[model samples]
Target chain A: MLENFKFVLSHTTHPGNIGASARALKVMGLSQLALVNPSNFPSAQATERASRADDILASAQVFVTVEEAVADCRLVVGTSARTRTLPSQLVTPRELVELILQQPARVPVAILFGTENSGLTNDELHMCNYHVCIPTNPEYSSLNLASAVQLIAYELRLGFAQTPELPEQRILDNEQPISREQLSGLLEHFDEAMRKTGYLKQNHEKQIDIRMNRLFSKANLTHSEMNILRGFLRSVLYRCQ
Target chain B: MLENFKFVLSHTTHPGNIGASARALKVMGLSQLALVNPSNFPSAQATERASRADDILASAQVFVTVEEAVADCRLVVGTSARTRTLPSQLVTPRELVELILQQPARVPVAILFGTENSGLTNDELHMCNYHVCIPTNPEYSSLNLASAVQLIAYELRLGFAQTPELPEQRILDNEQPISREQLSGLLEHFDEAMRKTGYLKQNHEKQIDIRMNRLFSKANLTHSEMNILRGFLRSVLYRCQ
Candidate 1:
């Protein structure tokens, strides 16, 4: 799903911003980047800023106009610094993610970011169905061009990328929940141990039984946890004898 | 509430990263920044990289150790490159935001980022209640320090900040739904116009009425839309005469 997104920077002045934008996209698992009439290309400054994301810069497509850049895109989104008087619906970056999710058919989405000083031009904004504005400090909204790309790419990653399970979670996946029979046997063991240890008084036996059952159910003990508990119970029973 | 959160960079090597981090925080409407033994501060390079967020750099607190930096914080979250073999709960950036939302009392949160080469140390990870790992391309997870800050700050902003209404949406707030009586009158006008145009036949009058009613109900037309439709109907009725 992330492959469907292509970030298009139109007439970006800073070569470093272009490089940083490539790095940003690569870090978020996005590879496609389109340049529309950039001031400089194949610049050393860009490669230096890109760090090890030179591959993204190498594979980046360059076009003469924004029209050609997003010609094949199904959904064109323009990033604006502020709201404008236009028919295009304005949305927050977060809301834009939801919009993309709702419209799965709108693949090969192109997100347009204008020059550093000014955001998307009126003509570019007119082309977009929605204008996404990253919420910033009302006083100082000077977000770096690369930072803006990083922000939008981050939102798209969160929206579309499937989160891989942690190593610990994968390890724990091997341990299944104990069966009902195993749980009942463990409960019986607990009952015997409690009786022998004089913990389960005759008058409160029913209460203890109910509470223990509820506790075990709440814990949802796995096979490994049940083994540990059963071992502890066996030790307690041997000690009581 | 953003003021309650602080970004702490420990033993950072690059001054540019510090400056960029400050800019990142400011862009996301966060102020507090604490550095632990940075290689260089009060450097011209730092200010240059900070763009115009000099205020954040000037107010940044310098700490000798991570413990002292987070002493006042109610919650400490460590940003890690990968999950470790520790007991601390590991979570994605999105999950970390949800965790913060769940624990409203855990204010004054401190998010710790380790050196560029190495992420949070085991000792630092031990201090955190939760370790948030940004999901990146497994093959190339080389996210820049400031870029990482930007991504995390972006998520925090989206999680906490209330999205302001767009100017267009605010303008549309004045448009109220037409009254039921007005809708009925409009329906009557539509019926008369259809009859005059011979579009509504004797045998299919009920069908036309039902379809028109359903279409109008589905549209949920605003007062302005109602007025436009009424004007169009009036024009049609005059033409019939």
Candidate 2:
């Protein structure tokens, strides 16, 4: 559900913020990034700031305008640090999350963030179904662009849990998420199969095993998913023999 | 309600993040920010990033360690982007907000955000009553330092609104917070009385007044308390006269 949301930054002036926004989106498991007429993109500074989040920047789609960036999106949300006399429905980030969850069918939702200086232009706000103002200190509300993105992204990630219980899956009921102990067994199987298949050379470093553990840990594999993977590993070993 | 919360960023590497963090806190109407052994501070980069919110940076209290930063705080909450094997009560950001609001009496609450590369060390995390995660993308959970503070500060603000009218506030009704202006007048009275009593010397710099403000700010004084202070000040003046 979170993957369908694309974070769109319009007329961003700093490439570093662009990079930071990418990192923020990725941290929350949201992948889509759209930049509308950024000042300096594809720059070294942006890359440096992105760190391991380079994949997000590399795959980031650049569009000519906000409309173009969110053309396919059904639900558009524009973030502003200050409240303005506007027509769009105003909601807090959490409220926006509840609003988004009401219609699960809305694929490819777009969350818009304006340039650092001024927030979304009037026209852009008009386009959004909802306008979100991060309740900030009225006296000193200079929220950096990427910081705004990070908070919204965090809220979206949270909304994933707040959403109404997902329709039950037939397979999921019988197969709970596998325990870490079970996952470790799967890794050992992979190590044995890979070693016999000459996939891992003699005197192979433990780094490969460590990475396999990390990769599987992220999979959040279910019991059935674990069986399928283990079955595939057995087949590979049989073919090698 | 939000005044008791204090944000602590530990072992921070970039001064810019520190300045950004100060802005983050102030914007949320949260005034307290404590830094633990930052790599660089009072740096030009931090000042530049802070923009007009330089006062938050200037008044920011620095400490040599996390323990010292949070020593005065009763409820310590640590931020973690990853799931660890530790035994602390892991909660979503919203849950932490709810928990903090549950006990309105827990003044000087500390929320700790660790360094950039690594999150809070096990020792540091153990110190927290709750381990809060912002619920980021599991694939790449690398939230920047100041951005982390911004997200937490934003939640704390929202939580303040969501918090059911604090029950303790009923007992505190007679002690409703006095404005900074009122607090200032009380400080001036203290200064004159102390001077008359041979404590403050002639042309003493404003350091004593500054310390008094810090002291009373923590007191969260009520209207009657302010009146008592003023009455005491009047008695002292009469004696001096």
Candidate 3:
């Protein structure tokens, strides 16, 4: 599936960006890299920037034009920070992941990244079926090219990576969260501790009780966590006596 | 919130990683960057690697000690590859995001990343209450320091940048976590006061010490709470004096 996708850098001014882009793609298990008229390919700066990912730069496919870069691609997605005036489907990085996952078997999916200053040209953007925008602060939406690639690549990997299923809910039957009785017991323990510390001299007991209850409720304490708390409280009570 | 999260790298080996980390944080709308005991900062390697993210590097904070770097921060989360045998709680990147979002208004939160070859040492890890681990392949879990920073910074941005209704948990509402320095001061004050009252004459100090530590740790006293406790202790000390 990684081999089928092509990440094309269009008119990239810096050779270092190309190298960094290669590293980003390789980390996410995406290997195919196509460069459309990079300023200086096969340069020492790029190889230095690629670090351990030199293989990506070595085997990179160089193209003279954007048209040649993504001609055979089944789907093309261009990355942009601004909302274009043209009518094209704009999706966030996560949403683009969902789109890619829904059709993993598709061949030659091209991700287009434009020049550093202006981003994808209108004609180049028109070639894409969708535009992918990484959500950033509206006040300062300037994102580095390689970083943008890294994020989009990460989303792709997360969508494709095989992860272990999350542990199933461990709640026992007849136990809906913590019972009111158990909550009251926990509150009493807290109140007793406060009293020992001379913190609940007034009717502040009610406020302390309410606050403690809220704290525990937010924890959604598991059975084991609850046991630990109870054991600690018991020890405290025994010491106070 | 964005301005408050300072990404501090300690003893960073690779200048490129520093640059990449800057780009990572910028893409996520976080700006503050700090370097503690870096091997070589302000090198051309770093500036070139930073690409257009030189602004972040230009304004980066350089500190000699991690303590100094995080002195102003109220919350400190250390990024680790795996959980150590320490009693510190392990939270995934997503959970850490939630925790950071729940921090009280405008308090600084420091996210610590160690050198590239060997991640944060036991001493550094001990400084943090929670260890945030980014789930990576166990077989080839060679995540670069900057990549780890990228993932965590991304999660933090997602958790805190959105404009949604306030979370129901309100976990950090009233309990502000006490700093290690504050905790140390309180412990010293307790010891002195106990000695003044003859509560620690015959090795009873050990038992009382353990109990007091547990009590304060469980309470999760904030900065203000620590001040209050110190104020109370001062009054008692005055009476004894």
Candidate 4:
């Protein structure tokens, strides 16, 4: 899947972004990188930024135009903050992943990024099969080139990452079930103890019983928990007597 | 809603990104800034990068951990390039805008950004209920931290920029509700009853009382709801007598 997809940077002005892009792609298990006339292709800054991902840099293909870069690719995607003058289909990064996954594995896919100052030109955008827009703050939608790359790469990685099917949850082993009779008996014992301590008057007994039931229901007392509670109630009754 | 939202940049490493993020937040009408474990906060380099937007830097909260910075916020959203080990609902920046817009004005929402080298850790991501991913180039998708902030902030601004219709609240004007004094009195009565039953003996009554108050306040009991509770309590007291 990684071999079929190629990342193309068109006229990237910053050497740092180019280098950072390499690192981002490598982290996501992608290696193919195509440069379309980068301003500073073989710069020390890009190499420094690439960190340990220089292999992507060494094998990077340099292209003269966006069309030439993506000419051989069966699929082409362009990234933008908003819709362009071109009439290409728009998809979010998440949707794009689904689209990418459904495509034939043999076909080469090309993702194009534009220059730093302005994004892909209208003609450049028209060359792509679809447009991918990253939703951003309308007021300040100045997403840096490399950050955009990272998000897309992250999505691709997530889409292609080996997903193990979750194991089914084990059914609870029922040792014993708390019977209604036992519950009623426990409630009666609690009420008698409360009466001895003047915790409940005649008018309040029903309300107290309701509250107690609510509390017990929330606790989800198992058989063992009910037994423990009953034992505690017996001790209270003994003290009251 | 946009005006009320605060963009907090926590523990940012690069001074330039800090400055850029400040600009991003200000443009989106989000003013609050919180910095956790920043490498060089209040640095001249950051101030220079901030350009004319100094207010974001001035009011920024500095903290040692992400928790301290976002303690008061009811909702927290973390930005990440990769999915963390912890479970979190992933959303695109656009969807996040809609979520933020729907929140009550009383609740403060926090957006967290991690260090430049590594995005938010798994632990940090766990703190957030939602994660925002910005789409970018697959081959060179290394997004700057500030740019990620910019995209999210931009989405938030767009979502909240419009005049919001008033939230429709269910009204029960006919019901006679308990006042704050009445509620306190009821709580005191309950505490007295609990003491008589020995339920309050081992527990820190003051702390429990405070927690109960918080829980009740969060419930936003209507007049009818208060009446029902009071009626139940009265019945309990009557039964005890």
Candidate 5:
């Protein structure tokens, strides 16, 4: 699955970028880099820039055209540093992850970057299913070439990695999320406890009751948490009654 | 909230990256920039790279130490491009935004980046409450500095544009997240309770006790949750006899 994603740099001007792109891909666990019509290649600078990632540069395929580079890829995403005059389906780097995940099969996926002077040619961008624009300063959207590769590669890794976790919120051994029935029972129980305490007033009853619903939903009361809240609510109800 | 998020670059080698960073921050609608021991600043190279966003470079704050740069910040996040030998509370860049947004008030925030070549020192990383790792290829993770700023600043903007979403996990009631001082007190309470119960054994005591601190800290216990835990501990202490 990881191997399906390819980074294609079209019309790259600098040899260092090809090397750096190779490095960026390697660090993010992406190996496939296709460089199309690069101004320089097999230069000492590319190898020097690649540092330890010379293997990636050595393995990188050269293409005569963008179409040839992305030929077999099912989904292609282009990176645009600026908002184009021509509008297209644009996704943030994070959103691109979600889009990729929704793909039914592990088809060949390519993320394209343009040359240093100008971004992807109109034809190259037109080949893409979506454009992932890294948000940058509007006045000076001068994101360095290798830097763009890093950001896109980072997003790909983040997408492949599981969603960020809140460790404390995960249920412990033998604890479960509260079921819908339990949730209903909880809301009813809250109503009774609030009524007993005379906290649910005449005019404010609907608003207060709505807020209670929202709060409990937001709290994500696990079964154990529900039990604790119920125990506290029972204690309150008993005292008020 | 974006106004309070300061991008602190430490010992930056390139004036252009620093200048580019100012543009990155400004483009994301954040004005504050702080530099800690940059190699060169007030350079024409930075101003030239910053383009029209020189106002950001003009007003950027400089500090001799990371501590001074982040002294006023309630939240300090240090960016590390790779995993380090030293362990830290690592948060994904997206997660950092959520955590920042969850802050109860608008406190100054510092996001630190290390020099272009070496990245942040272990000491610098140690200063942060959370370390944000931008996923890179393990083989070649040479991310350019300013791009790091752009990605993080973009996250901050995304965080702010988002409709004040409370993760389903956060306790939604009146209970506030306890202060660090309160957390310290709670840790002490747990330690004392464990000692009284004869639960902390001799050889394992230090490791077990420290782990316990981490567990509760990660839990982000709400006021009521802390009260419940403390009450349980008190009950256990009462039964220690």
Candidate 6:
């Protein structure tokens, strides 16, 4: 289960956090990591902080956007400190592990973390199916970004108990939710179709797009269902033409 | 429960690790820290790495030996990475927490961590009533000292339920989500806009409406956000007319 998950750090300002995050993942037996728009990479400070876990950093994937970073992941989770007015499925680290165990189809999970100063942006948080909040001292909730990763990784290590055999064979491939990339395509199709019909205005496009993304994430559309939505949007666009 | 426990670092080499350990403890609501014969103290690097956890560092008690560092504690637990020839009451971090809870007499418990290079010397390990080990990747078990502190701190946080009440998180007034009545209005506005766009056919209108509702409900839009979406829809409708 740890093998199928990737930790994505978005807009990390400090090089040390990136390196420390790599070590955190490695120590917990997790290898996959993705970095989005880091302020600095390939820095000596990062290498030093990573200690002996250079391999993780060497193989780390970098993306310009969080969307691209987690495009292939079926389950997208965001780590947030604040309980937003518009919240996703909020879970503790332990609860998150239980949630993962309950569903074998939600493989290749992406656990997203935001920048050091401000956690996952509203737009970024909107993209996730669930929001994981590490309970901290409410008075002094100033948790470091890498420390946050360490706690989450530690929970993953403790909760799994030697990687129990998941019932993956029981869940059909088509039953799995569509990948983030596929979902993005479906959202784009809807945007184009709505635009052609004159329902989407310049100012409202972003809000509509975000809302659709949030909605579809909750819907957890599978590949076949995504195809159906795409077909419907294509017909609408054709009708407008 | 956390107030009754103190973390002691024996022979810590890196000052940065000391600072980070302070941060790790403070984040998990642990305040008492004792250092035994650290290579460097009152160092700038430690302060920098401690981030805002300098208060813990400031109040940290330093001693010449691990014996002195934990002399006041009733239950002394040492953290060890390796399984020594003569292990004493070996337990995982989780188990250590359980052990602490079982015996309330173990108040003012001291948990010891050893040097960065060579974890707790045999003499140091012999002094402890229990050895708490954090399980890491066997192939690469080079867990950072501060990270180890973080992991242990996290377990303590989870194992204890009556965490001392820190101040409650302050949620701004405007950040509160819009009422359900407002949500219904927003969904109606979206339906009107979609109908005007000709994207919502009679056959697909119901599906579109439900999807929009689901999306908005998840969005948990605030009053201002609701107005933004409503305004955008009104603009689209005006254009269509």
Best by TM-score: 6
True contacts kept of each: 0.36, 0.42, 0.09, 0.03, 0.24, 0.34
Quote each prediction's TM-score.
0.69, 0.67, 0.71, 0.58, 0.63, 0.85
TM-score of chain B, per candidate?
A: 0.69, 0.68, 0.77, 0.67, 0.69, 0.81
**Native interface contact recovery, model 4:** 0.03
Error of 1 at A64 (Å): 1.4
Q: Arrange candidates by DockQ, highest first: which order?
A: 6, 3, 5, 2, 1, 4
Stretches off by above 4 angstroms in model 2 are A161-241, B161-165, B169-241
Residue A170 of model 6, lDDT score: 68
Estimate, for each residue in B64-151, the C-alpha lDDT of model 1 and write its tens digit.
9999999999999988655558558888888989999999999999999999988877789899998888887777788889988887
Where model 4 places Cα greater than 4 Å from the true spot, the runs are A101-106, A164-241, B1-9, B20-32, B44-59, B63-68, B76-106, B113-241
RMSD of 6: 4.1
- Report the C-alpha lDDT of model 3 over A3-91, residue by residue, as the tens digit: 67789999999887787787777766678899999888889988876767788888999999999989899899999866657547999
Residues B130-150, candidate 6, lDDT per residue (tens digit)? 888888888788889998888
Go through the candidates in order and give the clash count of each: 0, 4, 1, 25, 8, 0
Q: For residues A190-213, could you state the per-residue lDDT of candidate 6 as single tens digits?
A: 677667656675556776677667
| Candidate 6: residue A47 lDDT (0-100) | 91
Highest lDDT model number = 6
TM-score of 4: 0.58
Chain A TM-score for model 1, please? Answer: 0.67
Across B116-165, the per-residue lDDT of candidate 2 in tens digits comes to: 88988765765565667766655576788888888888888888845666
Could you give candidate 5's fraction of true interface contacts?
Answer: 0.24
Between candidates 3 and 5, the one scoring higher on TM-score is: 3
Candidate 4's docking class is incorrect
Q: Top DockQ: which candidate number?
A: 6
- Deviating ranges (above 4 Å) for candidate 1: A163-241, B162-241
DockQ of each: 0.13, 0.15, 0.19, 0.13, 0.16, 0.32
